[model samples]
Target chain A: MLRQLISANMNSLLRHFLILTAMLVSSGLFAQSGGEDFMRSMGKMYVVVAVIVAIFIGIVLFLIFLDKRLTKLENQIKENGKAR
Target chain B: MVKHWWKILGVALLIFAFTAGLLTPIRPGINDIQPTAVVAGQTVSLTLTGYNTDFNQEQAPKVILWKDGDHIINALGVSVLNSRQVQATFQLPTAFPLDEINELKVSTSDPANGFITALPRLRISGMEKGGEAAASAWTGTIENTDSKGGFTFPYLPNIYESVRNTFYHVALWFAMFTLFTLGVIASIRYLLTRNVMFEQRAVSYTSVGILFGILGLITGAIWAQYTWNKAWSWDIKQTMTAIVLLIYGAYFVLRISFEDSDQKARISAVYNIFAFASIIPLLYVIPRITESLHPGGQGNPAFSRGDLDNNVRMIFYPAIIGWILLGLWMAQLNFRMMKIKERLLENEY
Candidate 1:
């Protein structure tokens, strides 16, 4: 049963990869965009956008980690106090 | 308190770095050319694409082609396609020496947009030894670019705007080194005093250091994909850093394998010190001796012949301070939470 589930996940992953590959080929992405093209688009603000987005996601992840810890700490304190 | 002041400083510095890093524009640069190599004396059409260039502004966007260090020629029939793309037809003098120029220096200048100075080696091939440059070949003079600059990062051709990754990629390593150093120091203090609190701080700082190191690797891979045209080049520096991370990773794994808390703390602390000691040679010395694509390694200019000028240094230095302080703040928070969990577990027993 576990092996079947694992195979299903692999099959779905491969399907998504194939679809993305097909889209990339059809769109002429390789022919069109060089390395600098993405950064240069929209008056060169996209590099800034990429950077700000990366930092934003990093900070958000840290916040989530903090939040999870705080919640766990609060729960532990409450349960102990109630037992007392 | 005194501690609170530094935390405020960290936040303030980051805000400054963000504004300065993002707001500052890259100076003009030519990124690449199609038909990079050309047959001499043949009429070759070349497309030149660049960043922050204003070819449209020029009346006749001209290109100077240089053979030797001193010799220069004007490419024939230059036309501006757009702001970024310029096409030039070069009618090469049939007898120009192939050995004389492996690459022809291609320079385009606009009065308003400034110059991409020091462009050389655009790859001219297949020409015999020539007489002096024909009078027609010397169509225009190679003049210097005018600077209309306030503050800007030096425009690196291949790097382009991604030069801004200096803040995230390079500074993350700086922060990781700072945090890891603090971790090793705390671990040493724990060894001397047998204080569990010192051990806690050591573990907390190392954990946060690991997080930043991972983030550095990710940012590097992203930058490399755009700049070096690969996600992972397996460059010497990359391999060494991965190995360093793996050694520290083993420290964490070893901690989990210990049943006794004291054993976990002491042994991991020792391993942490060993990890720190090995990393200096791994990150610093070894990569210097070997070839590496990394900016500072193997005597490649500390990011291209010191192209990092005052404009970038202003934001870059502060960004390092902010990230290190921010990493420390996270470590402190984690340490306190660990204490909370520790006390609660004691109550359960």
Candidate 2:
């Protein structure tokens, strides 16, 4: 029963991830034509967006660093349990 | 949940800062003026361009050439070319009231949009010396127009709406500095107590501080690219901040180089103390003493009354607090994770 539930959750998560990726890709294509000029004409609102993106990336990178540390700890614990 | 009140507050303050900072309309101001210089004793038709101004409102706009408190010349005729453009004809006196050649400020006052003045654009020449009698030739009285009442950010030249980045980009540096201070405190505590917990805290805080410092640099570079027309200008503040981050970066390298935990903590604690000591001079002292393109350099002070007005201060202070709280929350989580890993390793041994 737990396995079925886990598989269902994973399927939905994958579906959502695919949808988000498609949307982003489509938006990227849409923004390709004169988007730079449009953003410039809007009094450089793009700079604010760029700054926000940089901060977001920085936070994500820190989270990834923490995750790696956790993974290392988990692997170390598994190794010790096996040895014991 | 009750213990997490600060986390909630941090998120709330950030929401408030982003909404208020980005959505607020900037005050109306003059962008440009045509025929910058004018001759004395002549009727000159001047074109005034405005930013975020509406001239065709129910109340007509007034134009004036202001020399000083006593010597003011009102436009003979005012005509609206468009919402953003106006034509005003000024009849200059044969001689300026103050001097032979006068640099007069052009002012546009509209009831809806408020008043904005161009900086010494209208130069009045052909005035003879000792024209103090011409002060009596002024005819129009300066009338005070009530500006539309609301909260608005001050309009600054060049920076324009990109000034909104202050809440994000600058707040990151403030947050980074707070984390570094906390890390230094933890380092001192570790040295005194020789406790592993405090060492964990110092490492976590310093790591998060470095992350924030990197983010601050990236955001600042993006802001400079748009405003200053360059991404990396080798600005003094930028160089000093990069050096500070590198100093802290070496702290992490120093941590991993040691196999024994006690030796590692002791050496790193001493290094952290010295690193924190260097920040004061590099960022605060040297930047102020040297000529820097950044604000707060040389004789100018950052966060001065003129640099951050009351409206910006309302959001800016909240943003700094929010970012600092968020940084603390991240560091705390990292510290807890380190403690858990250490516990697991101890149990295994």
Whole-model lDDT values for every prediction: 0.73, 0.78
Best by DockQ: 2
Fraction of the reference Cα-Cα interface contacts (below 8 Å) that each candidate reproduces: 0.13, 0.67
User: What local lDDT does model 2 show for residue B20?
Assistant: 90
Candidate 1 lDDT over residue span B1-349, tens digit each: 7859888998888888778877788787777787778887788887888777777845656676765445667777888899888888877765653344456677776665665543435777765655555434544576755654778887765666667778877787899999999999999999999998899999899988976776676666656655677758998878888899889878876776676889889999999999999998888788878877778766642354676778888889999999998898988988997787777767852
> How many residue pairs collide in each prediction?
2, 0
Locate the minimum summed-lDDT window of 10 residues in model 1 chain B: B130-139
Q: Residues B120-226, candidate 2, lDDT per residue (tens digit)?
A: 37766786654657766665656764454689887777777777888998888889889999999999999999998998999889888988887787778767766
> Evaluated with lDDT, which candidate comes out highest?
2
Off by over 4 Å in 2: A1-40, A78-84, B145-148
TM-scores, all models, native as reference: 0.77, 0.88
Model 1 Cα lDDT, one tens digit per residue, A10-64: 6445533543343333223432565556555544445445544555555555566
